[model samples]
Target chain A: MKQEEKVDFRLNREYCKACGICTALCPKKAISADDEGKPSMINEEACIMCRLCELRCPDFAIRIGRMQ
Target chain B: MEQHVFDRLMRDDKLPHMWCRGCGNGIVLQSIIRAIDRTGIDQDKAVIVSGVGCSSRANNYTDFCGLHTTHGRPIAFATGVKMANPELQVIVVTGDGDSTSIGGNHFIQAARRNIDLTVVVFNNSNYGMTGGQYSPTTPVGAFTRTSVYGNIEPAFDVCRLAEGSGATYVARSTTYHVQSLIKYIASGITHKGFSVIDAMCDCPTLFGRINGLGDGAKMIAAWPEKTVSIEKAGTLSADELEEKVIIGEFVNSSRRSEYTEKYARIIEEAQRERADLK
Candidate 1:
């Protein structure tokens, strides 16, 4: 099996307001909405590390990181 | 040539600064240098004035005539530099507290006068240095060291403030978006009148720790997306607002001539009148 790249996503559920700002700004659509309209990761491979999703979140709940 | 400029401007011994890993201030600093390079502005003719803060350390790194002035007083110093030597292109590099808090009055007054200087406010939304205290740009209900639970005060809209203050050119960008930030800084450098460039930086030490974001990279990623320019802000509806924060050129106009130009013209006219009288 090929080694999967580690996706650096720092999600603070308590701070997350489920506003979807991250999902909207994400160019790759790597983020999707969960049943409760809260953002979730349905796909991680498409994340381009643009930091747009991270920078725009008002709540400061979602954080994207680099591989170690 | 680019490599030589970079080598001259940077101190290799300062290889590692105190800013957290992936901090945006460094990125903004690089962009500022690139803008300075693009303009081919004479290094000797360029002066960088910075206020005391984490971001202000940029003064030490750049090769230009740099001054790390008192806290929140970079604009005042820059103003003096320009007034004394109108030929030099003065740039003010300041932080949230340095630009919008203690130095806010100077900021407005400078713009009102249409001074020939570029003001780059590193808006990390907190006082990263001397502990993470609540700053003027900290969003309402956001966490801060002072606001243990959440920040209650509203944040300052920098672009709007600059535009309202009669700044000739106003722009906003985040460190995560490097390309946009470079363009904005470059444009501000070229602008004759007061130009304000708000570079949203990451305060991982104070802001990130309190807000639950790990460090610089995570905090930077938390930046909200930009939807539209400030010029088109009124035309957009609530539904069209994609990003929580709006970034880009907010205003660009040549309504009033710069302070230097007006002063020179006035002096010249007065001299001609005196000669005619004689």
Candidate 2:
């Protein structure tokens, strides 16, 4: 059986402005961005669940929730 | 942005606000929503007013009772709203150009009266909406469309102006300090008298492009190096503090009665004195 993830990092693409702040500020570099600046999950294994991306994102498009 | 918060505070139809890419308006709006939510003020009782500017358009995004007034008149309109219905929480969202240029008198007068209004000034230094014209808060030697050879005029500090104009609560925070910005705005909302929160933000497409400051993320990254807290600011020499933006609350006091409350008292006394005539 596959292991469950400890946390969830969600991005609402419809609301994202492609500012790339989350990708730039992510401590673990787990998030990457496309050419136009839209962010995407790159390596989920290295996640620290710090949620700085959610806190600092200008557009409020990112959300990280800790799982029980 | 929690799902619940987004659903509760924002206008879903307006998803992905029209602000420029990497603009600081979105961050400021988010901070405001969180702050208002923290204060637990009823959305109906709270009113948001704004003037003409990129920042002033913040009214269209919120789920609060709002008034998008004409250029440089949101504060005046808010004053009237507060006077007519003292029960409402009046919040004025203004830009540096709107508040310090044509509306300068209204901004200072509102503070002088100690009115119950929470004014959040988005000081991006340049007029972003109007082709990056240098505004009253544009730092000296900064490049703008109008300042082709760099600005020669000194910048006006909004926080200092608010403090000197008798504002009961005054705070200075950058969009970079999202957590502290939310706290200061929340404190301002709960405070009884005039509150002025200067939210210094980046104007990437305009201010940044004109000054060669790179994009939005780079400007936000520079916030830490450019800003100093009040405690640290006191220790720094004038020369050292020249370019450093000071963050933190500068004033918090309730020494004087709120303008609306004072007006209500006068109305009561007037009614008593004219009882026989009625």
Candidate 3:
């Protein structure tokens, strides 16, 4: 059986002010907002790891890791 | 464990900063650190100087030789530091109020001198630290604590001011455009002469709340609507571009001699003349 591909996303929720910039700039539509407007991974399988969300995050809340 | 770029540059002991949630200062700070990392500059040779204001607090988070000077005096202090040690990379971080309100003269004079210093002006359009008072860069008709009836004073386009004052490099960008902002900042740092980056940041807590601009997320989302690229702005008429923030490099004069180089040359010539007389 093939192993499932996985990527890690570290979010510092304390720092995140729910700016949604990452969600808006993500080309793969992999990030979405939760009920509190904070960002969350909606489709990790589709993530391209472009790091756009990580770079554009105003609060330094998001970090993208390599796929495994 | 792989450390984040900021983690290596920032003073981890000061983790969890005091800036309000959703403030764009963090974005600007990240861009600066990223620029420094990309330039491969020696951290030991870098000096971060900031003036009194919310933006000035950035020096507290960075691990470099940081100096939090008097209000609106970062440029003057940075200039002295650059002159004393031309080998050091002096970067000035200041707020709209600190840069344009009280430090306006120093800002223009530094540009006029063409000193080798990189200045990043965090322009949130109001005095964020002081309760959202309208600043010199505040757009006309913007509501603020002091401008309850709407601001009547015209705003100063920081890029134009720097260019007019003879800065060798000048650029503008907002927090929303992270890539361009980082690129411009890196270019500014690499530039040999006076470089100015007028970064339009969002002061969500004070400016947004008072202006009805919603939360930090909404304010950033609306940045695209308020800003126009320099290339696109060129094609638009004055009326069409009203109230739009222009983002792009306005000047880059690598041919101009930097202040320290010129001064050093004068000193060298004087010493040679004295030696000949001896």
Candidate 4:
């Protein structure tokens, strides 16, 4: 949960259909949906790189990787 | 330099795809690409063949050797391609209507032949491109344009059909389980003989609208609750599992010889006989 911890993520907002699967399944509560239903990482520090969001995004809009 | 995955894999010119918002085709497409990347397949040697339908459009967006073939004939087309060049990795992307309805014969025949081809059927339950008509895999009692009174016919379990038809590898996954889909797809591609990945996708526009289901995203979000893992599915009775989608790898067999391999053996024997006569 360090502030400097590197948790790289990329979301193709254009492809996102705002299904909220990632937000619902994220164990760390790292992803959340906006009013429009589009998802964004709300807590990068909480993301233990579990990749639930990246794996469960039905639109293939999210990609999570560790910053090298 | 490590290139961005999508940049290296997708056709940039075809930026925005034609699928409707919330359709699971994009998810399945990405899963296939990720599988290919994970397996380290040579892109130059990979060929993607697709039949007519929303799923077939995947060939148009992928940066690989692609063939958009006639409706319900991708399996047949892919069979020939694999036979001609056994070295190339051939993958067929097809819809439920294209694969199991109009192309049903080819599907079973390909599996029976044990051809070395990876067939990915995007089962959105209805024909999305031509309006929401019930397809071969559409569940009974589901509403569709053609099934106004409800789809009375029992749906085919695509994985079970493939397994019965002699496919070497058979697996099922939904758009909700992207990781499992990718893993199964990669395993299917690596399997020697015919491999079938039945990927359940959500057609929010056609299937969802006609069935009174919500939009694309909602339909996809509902999958986890609607489907059960194959292992867990066994614990449920037939009545209990009636409406639930079963997801898992149903078969993986290395015993059967691939069509191309069998053909090669025949050719070798013929050559030896000719040499003996000479």
Highest lDDT scorer: 2
Residue B93, candidate 4: C-alpha displacement in angstroms = 0.6
Tell me the tens digit of each residue's lDDT in model 3 across B133-169.
9999999988999999999999998899889999999
Writing each residue's lDDT as its tens digit, candidate 1 over A1-68 gives 12445677777676555545467557789888677656777677787777666545444356575645
Cα displacement (angstroms), candidate 2, residue A16, comes to: 1.6
Q: Write the per-residue lDDT of candidate 1 for residues B1-278, one digit (tens) a residue.
A: 12444466655455445555445676678778878888889989999999989889887777789889999999999999998899999999999899999999999999999999999998888888888889999988878879888888888889889889889999998876667888899999999999999998787767877787775545555664443555576778777763467888887888788998888899999999999999
State the iRMSD of every prediction, in order shown: 11.4, 1.2, 2.0, 2.8
How well does candidate 2 match the true structure in TM-score terms? 0.95
The residue-by-residue lDDT of candidate 4 on B61-154, one tens digit each, is 8999999999999998998898889999999999999999999999999999999999999999999998889988899999999999999999
Report the Cα lDDT for residue B31, model 3.
93
DockQ of each candidate's interface versus the true one?
A: 0.04, 0.71, 0.56, 0.42
Give the clashing residue pairs of candidate 4, or none: none
- Residues B38-72, candidate 2, lDDT per residue (tens digit)? 99899899999999999999989899999999999
Off by over 4 Å in 3: A1-5, A17-20, A24-27, A35-37
Report, for every candidate in turn, its global Cα lDDT versus the true structure.
Answer: 0.79, 0.90, 0.89, 0.87
In order, what is each prediction's RMSD in angstroms?
9.0, 2.1, 2.0, 2.1
Candidate 4: where is the Cα deviation over 4 Å?
A: A13-21, A35-37, A56-60
TM-score of 4: 0.93
Using TM-score as the measure, the top candidate is 2
Question: All candidates' TM-scores?
Answer: 0.76, 0.95, 0.94, 0.93
Candidate 3 per-residue lDDT, tens place, A1-68, comes to: 12444767888888787767788767898989899988889888789878888887766678888655
lDDT of 3 at B145: 96
